[model samples]
Target: MHGLFVSDLHLLSPRSACPHIETELADYAGAHKCIVLGGDIFDFRWSDRGGHDQTLEATSRWLQDLQLATENTDIIYLPGNHDCHPDFLEQLEKLSQQSKNFSWQPHHLQLGNNLFFHGDILDAGNSLEDLQRYRRQFHHVKPQSQWAHRSYDTAVGLRVHKLVPRILHQPMRTCQRLQNAIDRLNLDDAKAVRNVFFGHTHVPIEGLKLNGRSFYNPGAGMKHMQLQPHEFTFERAIPASEIPLASDTSTKPPSK
Candidate 1:
């Protein structure tokens, strides 16, 4: 069946251009049965800022509209660490109350023979050492004070917008962890899961195969000039002729 997949919309009032995405989604949902939102739908840092309540209310209303627009389609949300706060439960409840087609799910989900997660929970894998070094180079700026927060936000925005794309594309440890996860999944013969989907790396990836299963990371919709804004859509039903006959049976390496 036809389905839409997206993540990391990071919608906030000052910078949110989500209407275009939402409009496109509505058009797709009219003909699709399922819509999967991978993670980080809201930039929690921005949403926690002043006037955020108004933004939240507007977002809620937009979601309701989406529910109405999709009619019978299933809308599944997988919260990322950014939006996985305890209070988000209440917000999700409100959305559910507002629309029958909307629903929220845990970090991991099973769809037919596929598994999905935000991918952050997989740990940084062997990259912890590198990340630690990078973290040290960039001093920890507290979010406590408004000035500090602004400075930190600006710095982060600059890094994501100006630095990441050219210098840091993919981390070795992250790729390792992903491979580890896929390996672990293959041990479960009963599950018969042959595909995995995730977000949080904010990198658009598709058609990659690890072990025997197809791997997909739809990337993020959040725009940072230095980083690419990636999105993807997939179909669940594949023709038998398209299925690979020989599959990799080797175990994935262990995560550090």
Candidate 2:
């Protein structure tokens, strides 16, 4: 079976880009057996506060449409930190009830020889570290209002643009950090799997090897002018060497 993988869609209703992504994903799902959403499927906090009810309804409708269109394909939704609310379980239950193909799973999933995670728990070389650092640096300046979320997001966007090129090209430190995380995970006898997929970096990277395993981050569906959002398809019968690697290393911007 062939599978599709995507992450960091950060979908919102008013955003035309997100709708386009949904349409594209639906088309892709027609040929794939499964679609794995790595994480950050929604910017829930921002949507809850900044978005109107129409946005919520539209997003929900889009999801339903995708579920219907991809009836033969399994849609796996993994919760990211942004969408990991206490009520997440209830929300997912509602979503599952609304669509036949849609299902919500825990942060991690094991499929055949592969282990998939939102990659937040890997806790190394993630963009979140920089984002946290910036947040701390401007904590006093940042207001406690909901608008602060947008401000922080904007700041992170600017910083990532400046840093990503340097980071992806000379990524020794980052690669080491990611490898270390993979090593720790492999230490768990039960969870020891060869292939891994993750997405916190927002940088679409493939061909990362650590301790005889491969790691892939499909990047984001949202496009930032500098980096085009990407989608990945994997064939179960195809060997690792056969997959085409992506050349772009820049982070895709959130679709507006």
Candidate 3:
């Protein structure tokens, strides 16, 4: 099925979220044949959505509504670092088992020639084995102090969140690191894969070719992050020459 990929919503408690995004996403789901939730759809560490159980409950209800609203669409969820809590994983697993349209994968998902992941594997010193191990440990980590979220929110408001990454050239560095990581892993489909789509850097990119693969990231749904959903038809393979170079297009700025 043709699909749209979105990530890094970093959804907090309903009281703090942007309700319009929920409506927008559901509308996209209805229009697309599939929706791939790339990762970090929920921010457990920053969620004031009550406690862990409450947050999961809210998440479950939200998913149920989305599913009901878009029964013909497929939902593919790849867990990101933020929402990999053990109990949350259990909930997703149960839902996947019970529902025909919903599915979840812990690490990476391959659909057609495109590889989808949360992009955590590109971290500075992490090996392939570290992926699941890190996620398991993340479950036990407590919520961040409210002050920390407040400070981050302030920075996001000031658009410093976008500025720092631009200054450091994080997107280019991330692309290089991702290429290295891919070579190191030597994925079974490495030779066949032509495109890699990921989220985690919170920086949106399109058609950025490095090391022979076109990379796409939809950025984040958090305020001022310029959230965008990418559409991909899982039919013909995208030729390298068909994709434009990143230098040919201006990167979308985070919304004010």
Candidate 4:
């Protein structure tokens, strides 16, 4: 099956949504059998779209439109720390009930031998319990001031956020953490999983192998000059030789 994976859009409103990339993404969705929204697709905590009710309404409407636009494709959404608010969860549940093509889970989605998640659980050490607790904290976050967003925009413009992560090798660290977390979980289908796909670190991984399993991250889509969502076909196996190392400074983006 053909699949498209993306994460960390951090969509606040039309102003920050990057409509051009979204247009491309919509086309990609139409062409794929399924699309997994890895997480942080909406930015509730820093949303400039208005207060809670307005932001929720806008995001909900956008989701409904996307669902309608991609009628034949399966849409699987896994909420990240930023978008896991209770009201958003309710909206996701309603959409899942109303649309056969739409579904959402709080943590991860597994299809065939591929696994997809938001990856926040691996951020501060590999702990599913910690991720849940962190997500719970998202419910209490109030929207930040305009100045905060401005400072963030400045950092992005200067590429500090991207550079720091790369220098520190955040992607490899995250992949290692994920491998440890997976082993501890001892999932019944662990043997079936071959590829692990995740986001939230905002570092794109073409491919990184650990313990015989491959990992990938599509990077963040939020006004960053990184690679966009990546497409994969489950029918074809990934070639190890073609994958680049995280240390390939000339080819890979900054880490984390």
- Measured by TM-score, the strongest candidate is 4
Q: For model 3, what is the error of residue 147's alpha carbon versus the real structure, in angstroms, after optimal superposition?
A: 2.8
| Candidate 2: clashing pairs of residues | 224-253
- Mind giving the per-residue lDDT tens digits that candidate 2 earns over 1-256? 6676777776651221354766667687754367877766765544533444444454567667777777777777766654554344345657866655666654555556666667665442345443323223211211135566566566556766436644653334545566655554433343456676777666666757766777677665444522233344444533222322111212211111
Quote the lDDT for 254 in model 4: 17
| Reference-based lDDT, residue 2, model 2 | 62
User: Model 3, residue 183: what's the lDDT?
Assistant: 68
Score every model by TM-score: 0.67, 0.65, 0.82, 0.83
Poorly placed runs, candidate 2 (over 4 Å): 13-19, 48-59, 97-100, 124-192, 222-256
Question: Any runs in candidate 4 off by more than 4 Å, and if so which?
Answer: 13-17, 30-32, 124-126, 167-169, 235-256
**Superposed Cα deviation of residue 113, candidate 2 (Å):** 1.4
Residue 175 local lDDT, model 2: 53
Candidate 3 residue-wise lDDT, 157-210, digit = tens: 798977876665477788888877776554567777778889988788997987
Clashes of each: 1, 1, 0, 2
lDDT of each: 0.55, 0.54, 0.71, 0.72
TM-score of 1: 0.67
* Better candidate number, 2 or 4, judged by TM-score: 4
Q: Residue by residue across 72-126, what tens digits does model 1's lDDT show?
A: 6767777665555434545765565555566665445555666766675564333
* Model 3 alpha-carbon drift over 4 Å, by segment: 13-18, 30-32, 140-143, 167-169, 184-186, 236-256
lDDT of model 3 at position 157:
77
List model 4 lDDT by residue over 1-256, tens digit each: 7988888887883324466655665787654477888888888877887588888988888888887777777778888888888778777767876776777766765666888888877654445566666677677346667888788878878988778767655767778888777775546588888899888877889878887888998877666546568676676422222322213323111111
TM-score of 4: 0.83
